[model samples]
Target: MSDSEKQCCAPKRSRAGRPPDPAKDQAIMKAARDLFLERGFSGTTIEEIAANASVSKVTVYKRFCDKETLFEKCVRKEIGRMAEAFDVGDGSSEGLEQRLNAFGLKLTKFLTRPNHVALDRVMGQEFAQVPSLGKRMFEAGPGQSRARLAAVLQEACDDGILTCDDPLRAAEDLLVLWRGFIEVELKFAVRPAIDEESVRERVEHGTRTFLRAYQR
Candidate 1:
């Protein structure tokens, strides 16, 4: 079995005296995430999720009102776990270019993970059925990531490391630059899977280009 499969099956410890078991919640989310990625939203069922989680259908319902809600929670949980990609250091030490490179590498690598790519495909398919899912996922993930990167850029501007009238716009541009055609190619299987060296080269190129345009 794969590492992720093993992780899903691993026992989770929980605290006592809670009405809702955190362990059960983790199990449910793990099962739901795997099923959604493998089968997309429409194909996966609550019965399957409950079975995989070793919990009853009612237990799943008690934790999450519906399948849509459970899906959103799973996506949000993944996004929150990857949020540290935007850390970019304390801003008092790392140079703007260096920080951007670091952030770009982490962000792009996270975006291109097999599970994340699968999740994106699932979201694309489900958006037609659950219109609000796209909006909520964007706000919870990419929108929040952009805001964090914008704060980093704003800090650089304040420190005279860069010149930017709008940090948010700059952040978006940098993200687009970093993603480039790689994301499209990955999504469509137009090329072989990206390796660490290729990712680093792309990130470094983007960071340098961004600094050239924005550096004071």
Candidate 2:
């Protein structure tokens, strides 16, 4: 595929030319993301990102302050992808369980991916050394996405499909449950089998529990 339409899931490449296609920005971020996940926070560098992305150091520095900034951008980009994966339907007429089941399934599928789990582990390890990095990651990733989910939960409550005293907390709880379910067995260099049927079963169970707690 063309650079502009390159798959977001692909590994880094080396092709960014002058007159710089906006696609180069994606290339840079993609490179940074792959490196960060593979090497962790301190292990990555701007020179590496530039070389991997086939862009100039000046190009990388122009967009990010340092390695930290690039790492943050990568986290944001990945989380943005996760958020985009969930439909979280806009005020659908469907029952709360139906909508949540779909959301849970998509979320589980994304989180259970081996690469995604590895990325999360890297972020977790980095966060221990750099607290602010974790904060930035939360704000950009789960923090922003949770707000969107909270809004949807509030809408559901208002529509009388659910009974949540604090929609934000409820949304957060759902996210926690979803993450816990999918990440239960994920560990570095240890990827256990997670079939489609198992994922759907887990999503169904989680969605059912969430609904039971909130259903009106």
Give the winner by TM-score: 1
lDDT of 1 by residue, 1-216 (tens): 233332322233356643546788889999998998788778899899999999987777766767777887876776666555555455543455666777788788877767667667657777767678778767767887788788888988888878899999999989998999987887787865788889999988888888889987
Best by lDDT: 1
- Candidate 2: RMSD over Cα atoms? 7.5
Provide the clashing-pair count of each candidate structure: 0, 0
TM-scores of all models?
A: 0.79, 0.77
Task: Give the clashing pairs for model 1.
Answer: none
lDDT of 2 by residue, 1-216 (tens): 233322233233346633546787899998988887677667787788899999877667665656666777776676566555346555544555666667667667867777667667766777888898789877876787777678778888888888889988999888776666447567644547588788888777777778788877
- In order, candidate lDDTs are 0.77, 0.71
Per-candidate RMSD vs. true structure? 6.9, 7.5
Model 1, 213: alpha-carbon shift in Å?
1.7
- Model 2: lDDT of residue 50: 91
